[model samples]
Target chain A: MKSQGGDPDEELVVRVGRGDPAAIQALMARKLPRMLQLARRMLDDAIEAEDVTQELFLRAWKQAPSWQPGVARFDTWLHRVAVNLCYDRLRRRRETLMAEPPEQADLGPAPDRGLQARDTGRRVEAALAALPDRQREAVVLCHYQELSNIDAAALMSVSVEALESLLSRARRALRAALADMRE
Target chain B: MGMMDRTRFEALAEAFGGRIDLWPDAEREAAWRFVAEQGETARALLADAASLDEQLQELRPPQPSAALRQAILDAAPRLRAGRSRLWRWLTGAGLGAGLAAACAAGVLAGAVSTGPSADATADALMAASDDGAALGPVESLGSVDTESNS
Candidate 1:
């Protein structure tokens, strides 16, 4: 029986709990893209993002059997795990680059997009990388991953107003950083 | 909700960017009302908000490589199997070791309960040693008393 705001993954998680391989595959298919997107945006490293995403699923497999339904949405739990993993890596990274700028992922180019578009994309990436860690995280969760502000706030373990303030500051900084591009 | 004045309107735009629809539902109506009443001024603010949002689109996350996908798929079943195997190994080893310990304890208990006493065995060993000493040396096994040997 579905509750008022039941997770659609409840049934799939149940099946996964039963050791269903197909269910694992289905869950991966459903979750991997967004998880990968979140990690890539947050970490800016394809390999590390893949590592985080892969680990997320591995943990999902381990947790499925004991997963309690209706406690929290599986997707939410999964995102929390992902964001925490990103934070762990970020913390480790901060030690080495205390004064240096955050490293950018080697995004290269898309064949379909023109040179100008590629240049704008690179500038955007650089600007995003230049953001303060918490602000960047808020933007990634809210704008890039398209999570609701409420959910993003929950994931960040901050109040909604705090989350909004983070987003506001992040947007302002981004606009200022990219102001030259608009002209 | 009160009518969206200039300060509130700009704050909303700054917080939520240009997308009026993307604003939280609680403020959406007031935002829309403000946008409708203020006309070009509000529209200009929205335009400013949309600028960064537009550039952000250029930073689209790249699709995961095919190799990465395959690697994850390959790892999934292995990880699953590894968990089960580890569980089985731990439990199996524990049970096996426990059963072996129990059997050893049983055998020891059985020996203590049903077999000759330690004192008797020690005395018998001492007597045999005494007999061997009386027989002079181990090199003269044939010289042992036949009746004693019997």
Candidate 2:
């Protein structure tokens, strides 16, 4: 657990093992916003988003004892957790929608970007969100999480070909969403 | 849907991926040709898929929050501290229980001994006392007669 600082993530993790408060603070200072951002996008509610983000890190901190090098990268694990939490929140929203047909689905903070960028990003999110949860997940891991297609497909618990099909549909959906250009 | 042939799909996917935003025109065009030859269905699907991919490419990864990085670092130590506390409690309980068990067993054996109770108790005590010595916790039968015979 010596802080050789050779690897940033590893070094911080080592510091954390040594009970360094600074490392913990340093970690939060870095990851909280992105976690929150991811949470917000997935949940579409800032408060719940923030909550998920906090919970993700809290679990991460609590699991440091058995932290190992090769299982999955810590960041990847956190992103996975965030993704799962988002799904959980989405399920609840679906239930709520079913229960009260009049209530609107609160799609979270719309990303602020250029006209093309914003439109494309939203179209993609909507397209992705429309797919079956697993397929959507495959697309999210590959495109949003920046995981390799193989890795994303594996994470979705599906064959790579199945994942490619999912990706194909996700792409088709996005094109439909954007290319249609109808209100 | 079921996959196309593995090799064909791989080749198509490989070609399709190469044109991802910025790649050499010839390579990308070649990849496009491979896709088109796969049939109209493939071409149409990929055109749509590629456009959507181009759209998705717009949703950039945002700059992570200051809080996020800190949360990660903070969580690691907090988890370690929690585990550390649990371990301390477990080790302390184990040591205490082991000592209590040993005392109970020694007393029971001593009290319930045959005619040579005191000698047996002395031997057991010596064994426990020398637990951390050079021999490292081996019980000695203390039979010189046996050694000499050997």
Candidate 3:
């Protein structure tokens, strides 16, 4: 379905297109955190995620001048760019066959026997990181980013039904992996 | 829309958690109706899914570090005062005029550059102003050195 009108970033983007310094700052404030979170979750690496976010904004500045509104929402378009960059990094990692494995979350019993709130959060992060790439993307987009199924599916270039399948598998695996947290 | 069947309701709850609001727009009304009709059974079906959602919420997103924010802001596009005025006038004149003006600014910037670093900054600006030229690498433009323009 077509996204409804009135993208909040529309006016600010136009200003940025014209090289308005204040608008540039405002767009950074509004979008930086979101882009960071999306990258951090998708890549499961803080440093690499920051790199992706920076690159995303650089591209944003270039695209702004030629930006055609009413074609697609700016935020959605940004998400697509961020997602593609993450995919590129992932592909590179696979091609290189990096010596160190991706970090694994400690799923064993909590050392304290009772998990702290912080520990629970860590465990969840580990579980999420452990998910397959596409599954992780599905969960991150739908559960964390809270993009609509339609938007997320479109960004992933999959049908809505396929996106649901990814979500179901991801959530089920998470439910199993973090089962003790529920207790 | 017809009321959601129990099977479909369970499937959606499993995939999208227990929040009807998060369900696809097309299914929300049916899901709500099913909830109203099913009552306890609906709550029972949602219990595990809701618990999972609650646990998932525990994973908070990391905050962007100040250094990262500053680095990104540093790389952002800047419009030099002189160039902005020139661009406005040229654009008002026409496309051909704009292109000619951009070439003039490139010449002026290059003339002002005496050192390698200064030359690189001029090159970056030229690329930025030229719609046809692809953007240079992010590292090259990270610090635009706007003082040179002044």
Candidate 4:
């Protein structure tokens, strides 16, 4: 993955701490989509994803004032926050089986190859959501979010070797679940 | 380093993707060597993983709604402002009695100001104070009494 140079959000976070509106806009543009993607993939629900994203930003606003710079990249910290929030919801889901079933996934219609892609995508998502939470988190972080193994491990708070183990298991499960996708 | 073997190579392909470039640097050369020596078998393993990768790629998130973005942007300032405003309100309530006590004890000078803002603030502060006697003098001094003046 390409580096974006030094932390761009350091100064913006300071400004956001002071409640600068432009800083909020800048942060949103830079962070919101990726956060939304992580949340949606983790929760497999758009509404919950939106709530998690909103709650994440609300936290950023609250934390900005006391934010200590250089400890970590703001983006990494934000992703960690998103993952934690998703875990909380996932835990709640397990505790109370009555949580609304995951929203109906809409695989948009596109021509031929696009249609196949959508069908495969839907299957992949269902298989992903079916995995145990930790395994699902490992795959989402490394595969979908494209975090390098090292960073993904750090975010998941596991040793690098442990992360690879998780990835291996996740892939095995996915490969089995998605076997039908193969000709 | 030992020559890359099929089982380990397959595991690498499964754990990462078909793309040797994405494999960890330490393993990439070994993986490449394995692919070179066992071209068809290596390719087959990678092809399986690549199929999964392709579907993973297809799992693109729906385009985030404009409203969601706007709502988040709109919310940032409000959460911040709301927090600070709540702090001010809480401080006023908690300190209402202390402030009144200070005025009664003659620890601080009192300023009498008239306006809707002062009236509302005084009413809130007075409401929050537990001791009516201590607040009596403070209110008499700060109360804007807009109702009669208006």
What are the interface RMSDs of all the models? Answer: 21.4, 16.0, 5.4, 11.3
| Ranking 1 against 2 by TM-score, winner | 1
The interface RMSD value for candidate 1 stands at 21.4
> Which tens-of-lDDT digit does each residue in A94-181 have in candidate 1?
7656666557543322232223434787778767776898999999988887777778888898998898899999988988878888
Tens-digit lDDT string for candidate 4 (A14-130): 777755555666677778878898998888877888888889988887788887777677888898899999999877866655455545443322223223334777777777777
| Model 4 stretches astray by more than 4 angstroms | A1-8, A18-20, A98-118, B1-3, B36-40, B77-150
Worst 10 residues of 1 chain A by lDDT: A106-115
State candidate 4's TM-score.
Answer: 0.66
Instruction: Indicate the docking level reached by candidate 4.
Output: incorrect
Angstrom error of the Cα, residue A130, model 4: value is 0.8
Per-residue lDDT for B108-133 in model 4, tens only? 12323433465565555454443222
The structural similarity of chain B in model 1 to the true chain B, as TM-score, is 0.48
TM-score of chain A of each: 0.84, 0.71, 0.87, 0.81
Model 4 lDDT vs. the true structure? 0.70
- Specify the CAPRI tier of model 2: incorrect
- Runs of candidate 2 with Cα error greater than 4 angstroms are A1-8, A25-41, A103-120, A180-183, B1-51, B60-150
Go through the candidates in order and give the clash count of each: 0, 29, 0, 0
Tens digits of lDDT, candidate 2, B60-88: 55555556444444334422212222222
TM-score, prediction 2: 0.53
Candidate with the larger DockQ of 3 and 4: 3
Q: What TM-score does structure 3 among the candidates reach?
A: 0.74
Cα RMSDs, all models? 19.0, 15.4, 9.0, 12.5
Considering every candidate listed, which one attains the maximal lDDT? 3
